[model samples]
Target: MRNVDIVQLSVFVLFLAAVTVVGFLAARWRRGQTLMHLDEWGLGGRGFGTFVTWFLLGGDLYTAYTFIAVPAAVFAGGAMGFWAVPYGAIAYPLVFLIGPRLWSVSHRHGYVTTADFVHGRFGSRALGLAVALTGILAMMPYIALQLVGVQAVLTVMGITGTGPAADLPLFLAFALLAAYTYTSGLRAPALISFVKDTLLYLVVIVAIVYIPARLGGWGNVFDSAEAALSKPDPATGRPSGSLVTNEMTHWAYGTLALGSSLALFIYPHTVTGALAAGRRDVVRRNAAMLPAYSVVLGLLALLGYMALADPGVVAAVREAGNPQLAVPFLFDAAFPAWFAGVAFAAIGVGALVPAAIMSIAASNLFTRNVYTAFLRPDATPEEETRVAQLVSLLVKAGALVFVFAFGRSLAINMQLLGGIWVVQTFPALALGVFTRWFHRWALLAGWAAGMVYGTWTAYLSSSPAQEHFASPLAEIPFLERNGYVALTAFVLNMLVVVALTVAFRAFGVPDGADETSPADYTADAADRLAAPEDPGRALTGEGPR
Candidate 1:
């Protein structure tokens, strides 16, 4: 490892302190609001306008993981890594369809989490519990991946060390994160996202345009990457990378892109940002505008190929035994110390935005679905907000444990595993918004089957480099060819759901009560759904009376 660059470290520290201040002050951004309620604390007063919502959702969705891992994947897997570009491109269209409906129903019903929607929509606490558990489980590794991004920056900056002492800086950073998130809640991330996005946009644009010029232009960069990737790996006896998906990878790439697009908005963090909007139109507007990030993402993926063109970077990261550090190392080697620090800050701040949002999303799930629904049915809004605040800190602790235990070596695999677990909820949560024809029991059973199959198959997949959680791709059962494990499991899940729904109907098994009206699914911000109805004084994005 090289000696720490003081210039880069100083710029990074300055950015970190600035965002921390922003986070704490965010609680007062909209003054006179009592943040004692879940609506205020967990969803940022549900009053972010179009401009803020765009930044918030973009920061939340694109994430530090996208900034770090997509490039790392390209560095490691070649053309297959570019699946993120298409997946990101297709995601907003899917969000455009589902976002308004979810916002409408969630607004009309005062639902804070998807489990709250499921519980109220189907009147089945058991099914809501299932969804809640699935969300919390999936979010743990996803949050850990964000920490991995931060850790990569630190590692490249020469701040990371071994043992408990090595993690002190990370621990201190998250402590600050937990404190501001506890004080300001969703508003912390919302307010800080502006700064994060600014730094990230500047860094990514420079890396794409300026770096290629420094490295002998785009043509040379691509040629170098292709030459490197075409060489066969000594361990696996397969080509290291490719410019396009071949017979072996086509199925996995296509399925991963499609399935990830379907699952994107269904994750609790994604919905948390959507529902935080002040108006239904905000969600739709953001959906149309969010594709701009995908353009940046496509540009960002090329940095991986840029790294491959640098033999010094490839050798250093390979010596360090982590592929996820590729982008950070690339920036460190190619840029001056001061500019490199700015790039590191971009990634570090990028991780903070989504990490805060995800912790809130998971905590909201626990507070609404588990704590109140099971332990304290008479819990007040103030109590719910308090529990969520406490749980947010706990969620961060869990993510820290996961990162420390698993280490950075498996960051990408763990994220893929998280996706596999999360997508199983699609048949229950996402489909439930459009139709109530699915029996709650059938959906639950299908979720169970998919979770089991996905997990077991993922466990069985081992490569020459690793013994478990080797890759997201696996052979399709009975087809004897490789595909994304999550998508393959989801197909089995839907088939089981269909078969069980038919049998349950024939047996006259009761479908749970649905409290939502058809109009509720399409209600807009202008509708009377915003009027005071429930005694809890639900948020209408106008602040408390």
Candidate 2:
């Protein structure tokens, strides 16, 4: 940007260079006998211990989205935006109960993706394919949210205007993201996470301390937010929009949080981060420790009130021309110049770490589940790796399309829609891990029902602020508008499965054979002796049994 303070720009550049090095060098950190295998290139050889997974999962979940958007929500809405705080709080407990089971089973079977577990457990290629497709599709918009996160920061840092320079800055960002992720695989993002998270913690902690003190105190912060929420809607004279008080908001917000946490671990990208761990315990420890990020989330949401209390932040954000820049503008104007530089880097680097992980996760699904199963069943590991790399590029391109396609509000909704779609995979993929008694055809029927119903319900929801479908629910005559779209779709999915299951059983439709047994789903350690996938074999997908 034309007005960027030279000192802050230098600090920000230093941070960017550091992240680039971490990404490029991550390839060498965990050496596999073969680099081409899905297990190596896609997963970092499945050798990361608790410390690495701690960073990896932390990197995946908290993300640039949490850093930028959550605060932006606070800036726009009020207390209701803080729902993400409770969601993270509720997520770990769910992960604790379910993650170990998935790990135990996947390790036993050498499963590379959640879809792989579905394939072997239910013996249904179609159901496995649905899981893969949902994951890839959901990831497209979710990954784009990270770019949105970067763009929000860039907007504040003077990147966007009515000219070529605005586009140049973003294109440069894309080049850097593509370069690092391509070189490091999962390792690059995981390694970069340490610095990114540290910077985020520093920036948010400083803002929390400085902003509240400058405004007054927590009491004033709450009072200011309540005052804002109490204002009559310009459209409706009533308390317009949401005010996060009492059990109504509580249940809606709480369920949204829990359901999201349940869905989070099952998301292919999140699971991909976990599966790279050296042991199941690492997964467990990270599940517990990662919630520490939630505390920061709570503070970030509170910054909305900080912005509300300060006219300067409001004026600065308005000047920048986007609500997403509220937090960044507050930082630059409120804090000293050097600290603002570091905070900006926090958001920028934060984007790269999650971007890299998402690209890798999407790539793994393509190489292992799609190409191997349908296109070329005889493909080797090397082929799988090559194809995975190609697909990773395409995935990023699709995500870029999404990033450009929507406004911030729509982007948030699309990201939630992505989550809703991904959550539908839970029945076939997550539940299948515990048992295989459900017929494969039943699972497919359930998946189809869930997809159709979830999409339709989302489409039905529309607001003046949003097109297509908005706000997750509408106050309809017959239906309650309070709960999650995913929860409703999941209920419908299960109903279809039960109905079809009984029919399939009475009719004696044979459940195709599962190669894996219950005991096989419980192993956590990798097979050190087995040969890793070669480049040709890896990307094209087919591999040795």
Candidate 1 lDDT by residue in tens digits, 1-545? 56787899999999999999999999998733488888888888777899999998988887877789988889987999999889977778888988999998888767889888887677788889989988998888888888888878888888866678678766876787799999999989999999999998899888988888988998999999998899888777888779788988888888889878877898999899998898999999999989888889889889999999999998987898788989999999899999999999999899888999999999999998899888877777788889999999999898887776664664767678889988999987888889888888888889899999999998888877667777888988787778888898899899999999999999999888787789988887655343332312332123232
What residue runs in model 2 are displaced by over 4 Å at the alpha carbon? 163-168, 235-243, 246-251, 318-321, 475-479, 526-545
**TM-score, predicted candidate 1 vs. hidden true structure:** 0.96
lDDT per residue (tens digit) for residues 134-196 in model 2:
899888878888887777666666666666655565567677877867766787887888898
lDDT of 2: 0.75
TM-scores for all predictions: 0.96, 0.92
- For this target, which candidate reaches the highest lDDT against the unseen true structure? 1
- Cα lDDT for residue 202, candidate 2: 85
The residue ranges of model 1 lying beyond 4 angstroms of the native Cα positions read: 526-545
lDDT against the true structure, per candidate, is 0.85, 0.75
Question: Compared to the true structure, candidate 2 yields what TM-score?
Answer: 0.92
